[model samples]
Target: MRADRLVSLVLLLRQRGQLTADVLARELEVSTRTVLRDIEALSAAGVPVYAERGRHGGFSLLPGFRTELTGLNHDEALALLTAGSGRGERVFGLGSALASAMRKVVDALPESHLTAANDAAQRFLFDPETDLLSRRLDVEEVPKETMVEVRQAVLAGHKLRLRYASRGQAPRRCVVDPIGLVTVRDKGYLLATEAGTDRTFRMSRVLEAYELPEPAQRPDNVDLERVWAERCAQFLSEGHIAVQVRVNPARRDQLLDMAEAVRAETPDADGWLRLEVTFQDLWHAEWAMWQLDTDAESLAPPELRSALHQRARAVADRYRDRP
Candidate 1:
């Protein structure tokens, strides 16, 4: 290692009260002269490293010096790098910007920790996939400009004028006070407070949005986490399908991993696990059943089972019609 680089490493260890020139030289794979030069560089840069020469001697930092997030051990460095990658676009916002920040953090870590950090990255990957038999719950990416404005408005306690579209009606305009934003697997949504009542809006339903000039007067006691839970409960009550499935016990994890909102039930004597999953809609439930093939059976909610049967018959009917 270069003299300057070795010096930086020594200072990092010394800040943690683990400073020994001989140990730092071995750690850096360099000689004592290189280590000494590094100590000089640190002194030049105003990082205090006091050395005591004797049988019990090492090094220590100057008293009363504190730096936020410094002197990270190997595990701490690995954890920080791993957490940075998973934040992706929500906390960091999408694309190259988040990737650049992650790269900078990884670059700052010691060379010895690089392999562990790389392994951590490789172990976790983000991919969102839905089964073919399930109705595709399509989610649109909120424009980056809109996302930024929404975040700011929510933080600044401002109201927003939004153009919204429902499934069966033409787009309409309304003014709402921004509450918070929630990000599900691949989807993002906004929760807004209305003048008369509290309600949440999906960002995907927004056709257009503009920050209103009026002040946002929301209740000071507004609990965002509670609001999120309430909205989720409402979605499950009206927009969800209650699906019960009898699954082979060995295939439980595989099936649960494939579907969202799946709750495993007690296993029967036959070792088959029963499951109840909340589907976005009936079509989504039916599609998930199709993905499991014969390994699972949809029990409750006759409509879902019937839909699955009808879809299977249609495939057979197509071939029959060909003749």
Candidate 2:
């Protein structure tokens, strides 16, 4: 870990030219005393580093000093660049560090590989602001202070006290042991436990967070993927509506795309597709069916069919008066 910190220290100086001991300490997540010790170690190892002694003095590297990094080929360099697309970085409070590391990675590549790799990587875009339909993507705003405290607690194995604001409920204070942080579809959630029960808290709903001094009450090793999957399955099982529908051939794929689960799919006698779909609730089913217009017909659920019929009649009545 110290080796990695030393390497990062060198990279920071190489990229930014000069930084004070306090700045270096904060960036490296170490104390100012530790930073000074690392500076001494670097100088002892023949690195061209020196400190200026004045009110505005700090640490600096000798002019034209650059450390050579290896182990990354042309494609690998480009892959690293493409992966750091700047989306989801702010959730964990690593936006600035990611940007700086990207710059260092680009600089470390060979001269022959730099231009070609950058050109190839520029052709790929990740998490664009707008979709193909020209609709703007929704990005949740989480307070930076809250995100930092939550992340620190998780990484340092400490307990957290959260002021959580659930929908239709007043803010409540709860103490939780943070198991991990999961990001789904550009949204962040804190997977934690309270009183030996698993719970998921959306980062957006966290009104305030405080890191407690006590260690987290959790197992040493956790399978985050399994936990997330179990939570998702439990969520889908409760408060969901199952609807059977016959969709026209042209819109069958669109209907499937809108559904969370497709229990069965078969071709009907009239060449239409019969799909057993699951939605979050009745409103979700109705909105999805409305998007399909006449291409979809609700077959089994009489209540859903009635609701759609009523909506159609109301629309027709309003238009008739206009004409």
Candidate 3:
């Protein structure tokens, strides 16, 4: 919820006129380092925030710059604030805008509820980088220049040229009529059409992108949710290799991360967990299972079991003698 934290930082400055980084950090429930970074982000976004160094000096906005948005109830403000932190500011290319809008939302609240609303919003966390077990979600990174180009084409209804890299494939050049962008679980996908056929490209794998001058050839109205659901359905119906596994409960998340789906689950007599999982193909299944090491054992699909056995033997043979 860095977005909402930024809003709170601005609100604190706006309320107190000027406050030192220590006070800002204390009030915002973050460190002084974080406060300084938020200040930089605000200034880069043209927020007119300025810092005065020395005793009795701190950060303040330029005179005559403030939002006049008001009349929002505490609950409404709370909802907006929660959304800001939940979706985060990185969606699409509007991180700055989201922070600015959330600031306005914070400012609109009655002074009595402003602090309470922000505190409440801070309670609900979503899609944080670290999970309960301290395992990190490897958030995908999309290049800024490439994302900007692809986002522009989608918004402007222009065709886009991309040096794209798909899974397990070499990067290649292609042009697609842009439809829209979709972000799920911190990963972004650019949904478009290549030669009148629907296509979805992971934004991270876009090595390079350029907004084309020509307009896109798209339907009159695009329902992104419907199109995405249909594509997901198509993928689900396609062939997948299903393998049953008994895995240590502790590494269950690691196993599920690489699986396409979980079809069944149960606990074994010895306290291990048994489950049926699907992978993209046999190779994928083998690779996924191998990553778990001894934490998982394949129970079905003779081909997968044989492949795992062969892989283990190959490794054993390589290290048959100590290095």
Q: Highest TM-score among the candidates is held by which one?
A: 2
* Candidate 2 Cα lDDT to native: 0.86
TM-score for each of the candidates: 0.61, 0.75, 0.73
Clashing pairs counted in every model: 3, 0, 0
Name the runs in model 3 displaced over 4 angstroms.
1-70, 236-240, 247-251, 263-275, 291-295, 311-323
In model 2, pairs of residues that clash are none
Candidate 3 lDDT, tens digit per residue, 1-323? 88777777777677669889998887666799999999999999888899898898899987656565557777887778788885477787676567667656666666667778878878888668787879787678887778889988888999999998888899999999998899987889999889998888988899999998999999868899999988776766679888999999999988998898888999999889999988999999999999999999999999999999999999999989875
- lDDT pick, better of 1 and 2: 2
List runs of model 2 lying over 4 Å from the truth.
1-63, 86-88, 247-273, 321-323
- Tell me the TM-score of model 3: 0.73
| lDDT for residue 209 in candidate 1, whole number 0-100 | 78
lDDT of 1 by residue, 1-323 (tens): 36446444644563456567787776555687877777777778787667888887876777654433346676777666666654344541344345444544554555567667677667765443344445454446677767766777877878998888876799998889887777776567788877767667777777787877677877766777888888777766776777889998766766665565765577777888888877777777787778888889999899888888898898888888552
**In model 1, where do residues sit more than 4 Å from their true spots?**
1-73, 90-140, 167-169, 249-260, 320-323
Positional deviation of residue 191's Cα in model 3 after best superposition, in angstroms: 1.2
For every candidate structure, what is the RMSD over all alpha carbons to the true structure, in angstroms?
12.1, 5.6, 7.2
